[model samples]
Target: MSAIPQERRLVTAVPGPKSQELQSRRTASVAGGVGSVLPVFAAKADGGIVEDVDGNRFIDFGSGIAVTTVGASAEAVVRRASAQLADFTHTCFMVTPYEGYVAVAEALAELTPGDHAKKSALFNSGAEAVENAVKIARSYTKRQAVVVFDHGYHGRTNLTMALTSKNMPYKHGFGPFAPEVYRVPVAYGYRWPTGPDNCGPEAAEQAIDHIAKQIGAENVAAIIIEPVLGEGGFIEPAKGFLPAIAQYAKDNGIVFVADEIQSGFCRTGQWFACEDEGIVPDLITTAKGIAGGLPLSAVTGRAEIMDAAHGGGLGGTYGGNPVACAGALGAIETMKELDLNARAKRIEAVMKPRLAAMQEKFEAIGDVRGRGAMLAVELVKDRTTKEPDPQATAKVAKACHEAGLLVLTTGTYSNVVRFLPPLVIGEDLLNDGLDVLEEAFAAL
Candidate 1:
């Protein structure tokens, strides 16, 4: 890892000479389909700081898109993974099996929502976990259709793209998607046609009724949704909305799968966002924070539902690699030892107020919402109209990035500025990042 302090220090500029050189090389080698949010190339990242190839350091508010909740290069994770690396790399659980994979499954079964007897199957990414979760639901329910909410983002795979709601970047030109996937309205408080007060029940009724009338609930395999929509702007569904949907799925015998990939692993001040509403989803898909930046994802659910899949029905070559499993165990240990959940709540306590203050000053900040460290501000062209201002949002994000703060933008409309600082980030550094955000707004 590069030698750098926790403080944000810029040597030459945002994307310095070294990063620029690497960017030019990337243009020649990397494909156009892959997007780089910022041109800065990272050499090392620890805690809340990412040291670029140019030796300039930035306070990371993206957490590698919510992958490094325990912080990139967390000591526990590195140590454990190192030990596993020295011992052995891959045995392929199906081929010979390993204790690490079983241990991770045990940990996931305990950590994921619900007290009911639960089981888990490991995978390589959030998209794969969601794909397997859908498989499990279908095998258990004997159904073909999968229901996803408006603005909900699943993944980039064909099946997941079919489940995803966005088109421009995620689904556009991707073409002929998988079959039997349905999309419905989400209880997005800010954008609801009626007021937020009416969003919860109304959206739930609309979605449930649509399924009942159009797809026939009996044919629905699962209802998959992000507890707090990640890529689609950190829109936390209106209160009672999630529980109502879960209940409706329960009544209909449809598997309710909570895609807590970005919101799980203590990112939302709770182990999983579904726990905020005491929701015990039939299956929960997790990935981003599960292995402290290592590529690990899981589909944990009620034993009966999970066991419905036959032997050899799930898993990939790299699924639950021993080293990654070790990293997950270490990350889980770190979360418990440091009480990162409390730290996450503390982060929200510090950030939401600052963002609200910004909202008071900037009319473009039409809405400030989200929970714990995963918060965001929806940018709009008009307060009452709530017309998305993607241009202005991009401008402010560029300003922040140029100034050394790594804030991310999201939303179906591409007009939400998000803050996802690491849970282990010091209060001072968190404040500094927020200060940069404040300046970005002032510039706008």
Candidate 2:
């Protein structure tokens, strides 16, 4: 897939002179609101590594927040995109329809969870796809209320901001979110007050009861969830939780939407995360890794539900750009050719054992959970109380960055260090990144 030296080579102090200069320039030119996990600027990125501006190379543990599953410079993705670029960049799919768009939609229908007759609508990002899913659901049911879970993250748009659960960075000070959005409890096993064993059915029953008592199921339009919660940490809800919710959605005629922006593709060791639980969502919103780093998203759903939207009701200016569609086709091809689902499982097989060993040595690591290439360790001050240790999490991430490894921090409480390495990463490189992680914990 790549010829780039799959090694971590630090030629200078991390965030070295060139990167420091770029950061200064960025401060002046870019908005303060825009943030970065690492301050060093990327010079070039390939398979498993990123060479920063200072000539230092880093093992990429975060795949641009789980976007580049086929790697940054996958040959198939590049070839397809370059071919499309020469053919046509943009005529706007809405203006003059293209085969690439139809091809991408067809691919999604085949790949997404269900076998029932499916249709798709492409968009530019995950948020747009999610917002459109809500539109389709509401149009179909003539209902408005949308239900989401505790650790769920939809996006940053007004309605999605309401769907998202975080406060400080995402929703705070941004007053006046969209209405008709309700929040329910997520089956976070580690944080469940009762216990991990009871989290699944108990949390599901609690959520179902709340909806029935307060926001009557009959009035709800959609119930959106992430099979593996992303931004609110990689919390895989207790096993039976999703099935219960999906059944409730069915019984109440609520359109169940699976937001698979981060966990879609092969990141979760399956074509889609919901398949592990056998819960077929009525509609699924996908982006991020779907197009091998290109900005392409889609809402794929049952034909009857998708057709509810009128012809003019959906679509945007650059909803499915030709080049992006080609990139998606290439990405899907790479997924199939490489058998990335097995690769993802292999990554988990390699990573979980190493991560478990680290936890055995460090009490700060309270929990290690996730599936496939998407994995994380939740930091806490005490194993008993399980109080989040955000300071320790920050220090560990900073240490990894300083040592020429790129890692990311996420969680509702900001105490989880998430790893989303590229599936094509060499074993030696992945282990090297994990070695740095172990060292960071030792230093703490």
- The lDDT leader among the candidates is 2
**Over the stretch 200-308, how does candidate 2's per-residue lDDT look in tens digits?**
9999999998899889998899999999999999999998999999999999899999999999999999999999999899999999998999999999999999999
**Alpha-carbon runs more than 4 Å astray in model 1:** 1-3
Our model 2 lands, by Cα RMSD against the true structure, at 0.7
**Candidate 2 wrongly placed segments (more than 4 Å):** none
User: Residue 123 of candidate 1: its Cα lDDT?
Assistant: 91
lDDT of 1 at 62: 94
RMSD of each: 1.2, 0.7
